[model samples]
Target: MAEMSYRTALVTGATSGLGRGLALWLARRGLRVFAAGRRVSQLQALAAEAQAAGATVEPVELDVTATDATLERIRALDGECGGLDLVVANAGVGGVTHAKRLQWERVKAIIDTNVTGAAATLSAVLPQMVERRRGHVVGVSSLAAFRGLAGHGAYSASKAFLATFMESLRVDLSGTGVRVTCIYPGFVKSELTEKNNFPMPFLMETEAAVDRMGNGILRGEGELYFPWQLALPSRLLKVVPNPLFDAAARRFR
Candidate 1:
């Protein structure tokens, strides 16, 4: 494995799924990791599991939806760590909704966490990274962002928002020495994916997915899309004719 470019890191949504996997993986690689999540018990469990494996992971209780508090906590963590070398805005929520019977509450929850919360996580540490002229900011988007899917309109839109938001950051911070990476992952086993009732092509195990993600981050890739079997098709969806795409998407609904 290539040596990680960072020594200190923070991962939000660290209680479960991809966030949890990445947090432990980075710690095992010898980085000082701060794992932040809303669930205290899960956070403690993560810390204990890491410790048992002789890795360092500090658990932090954080609710990313509380934008003000989220910003303050991240800023404090940066100072406590003497400055965070990397921040992974991995916190997000997913939901399935349909246009005909859309529930505002479900849609709102997805936006609140996946968009607003993730944005706050990055925005909190961005200034310090810019001042130091060295740091990596990673956003965990989804292949779903490539095109809006049936029964996943809200979730797809949220990931699309994050992907574009990070892209803009990458362009704006071109020469500031701060690296920005946006990850677009296909279906992977997680609390989120377990709820899917439809078939998921090329579903990846969480560990395998995180390994690819971690390596890409270490290499400072601007954008990382994984499990090419699915990524290729998902990318192609961008150029698919609207009529054909709509016809195919309706089957999933």
Candidate 2:
């Protein structure tokens, strides 16, 4: 494992699931964490748990979809926490949409939260990292980004946007001492996946997923796709013929 290079970390969506797991992992690694999310009570509980474990965790109430306010809060936290060395824009939402029953509001929410919110979180932190010339920015995308799934078109498209955005940021920040990592996790156990009734291939538990993600960040990997059992297939899917891919994807529908 790479030695800890970051002293302070900021994690969004820390109230639950992967975000919560990442926050706790960072705290355990002895980094002071600013955990942000919309749920204040859960954040407080997380803070308490971390403190009990002899780690520092400060709960910051935030809703990433509110771009302006979210940016302001991140800036405030950067100053208050003695500047952030790492930022993970892990806040995201998922929805199942059918062509016949697709609600504009639901589709919009997914796009706003996944695409816009992810961009806002990164925008809020990148300026400071650029000025300081040292930091890591991570975006938790998904394996689903490889294709636009029938029932989750908006979600997959949002992730595809996010994956490309992270790549673009990496290109922009080259030689600037600021690193960007995109993690594409497949079928990890989380609140989002807990609702799914379909079979999840190579399903991984939360702790294992968190461990892999932490390792990736520490190693400063450009792009990390976990549980290669799924990632490899997803990568191949990108090159598959549209007709063949459509036939295979229909099983999940």
Candidate 3:
């Protein structure tokens, strides 16, 4: 186990995928981890697995979409833990929302979970962190935030919103000892990505992707984009002419 600056951490969306992987990784590194998710079964499994590995991981049943409840639960958890050294707002939902056949329900879920839920998770911890002048907050965004993909309009937009939100927070909190990191990841194997029927380039396994993100969070990077293969092109797409970018994005449709 590597020496860590953080002694206690909370990871939202910890029932599966990157969130689960990150929670376990942090525990293994000697941090007391609070894994929050909606699935009781999965949370129990996570706690058991961590215990077997001789790590501390507590499961907290939370639905980030329930703003009031989420805020209350996390604040109480933070107080119980004495203070959260790190908080990862990794709870997010993804789906293909074609512009022509857009479903309001799907788009709303993406917004509620990815935007509202993530914001609530951070808000719940930030006040104390600010008062104490010590903490790290991470936001899991996506490379798709660089451009609005043809078939993933809403999902891409939500990520973009998160990235911008994190960036703003970083600037606002500078010199305050609160570190803000926004991670833009490419495709990683997860429940959310498994539903994609179209091709996913530069697909990454959950463990490897989470490892990279974990390192970045600990290093206190302001913005981390992984799998250079995809990150390079995605960064370029941000400046590509709209006419050219649209032509290429159409292939996903």
Candidate 4:
């Protein structure tokens, strides 16, 4: 693990849940934080709290889904913070849908926010990071990426893309100072998860998820899996044969 201190960190989806938790934790560590999200009120509250702790908290009232707006916010931040040391793309959504009867609208929204938005955000910042040859790109993917999941095809597939993308990035930047880490967290109790009707085997609190992510990032882990148990099982299901996976998932049904 490199023991370098970061002066600035940009966290997306920072209004509530895991994103908010990560922003707070980073701020308390004395890093200037640029929190981006659509919720102005909650961003304000987070800014105020983070400011009280001696961290320069700039709450960006920006929509990442808007390409121009995302670029503008990031460009302004480059000047405000001089340069970004770490970027965390944590925006995502969850909904249930079957392959045969997928909710195309929800799937579209998920692809837009989770995949396209992340790629756009990375595009906005990576050029500078590459120019400086110093930075970290951490994404909040999910263990769902390991499997197709029962009724959450869109969510799982989107996360799978992130997992693969980040891993490839890590390899591509091996010699460079820039590092890419993908976070595959298990069930966490948060707004994104409160709507789930099924039981989450190893559900953790947002703070726990925050700690897990931070530790993973600090350790320079190429990929992260929280609570440990949910990590390989999800991956193993895919390896075990389609018939076995179909049988296992039947329990959820």
- Give candidate 1's TM-score: 0.97
The global C-alpha lDDT for each of the candidates, from Candidate 1 onward, is 0.94, 0.92, 0.92, 0.85
Give the range of the ten consecutive residues with the poorest summed lDDT in model 1: 1-10
Q: Candidates ranked by lDDT, best first?
A: 1, 3, 2, 4
lDDT of 4 by residue, 12-98 (tens): 999999999999898888788889999999999999988777777788887777878898788778767789999999988888877
What lDDT tens digits, residue by residue, belong to model 1 across residues 1-253? 2233678999999999999999999999999999999899999999999999999999999999999999999999999889999999999888778898899999999999999999999999999999998999999999999999998899999999999999999999988889999999999999988988889899999999999999999999999998999999999999999999999998766
Q: For candidate 4, what is the TM-score?
A: 0.95
The lDDT leader among the candidates is 1
Model 2, 240: alpha-carbon shift in Å? 0.3
Query: How far in Å is the alpha carbon of 180 misplaced in model 3?
Result: 0.5
Clashing pairs in 1: none
Cα deviation of 109, candidate 1, in Å: 0.2
TM for every model, in the order presented, reads: 0.97, 0.97, 0.97, 0.95
lDDT by residue (187-231, candidate 3, tens digit) is 999998998888888899999999999888888788999899999
TM for candidate 2 is: 0.97
User: How accurate locally is residue 205 in candidate 3, as Cα lDDT from 0 to 100?
Assistant: 95
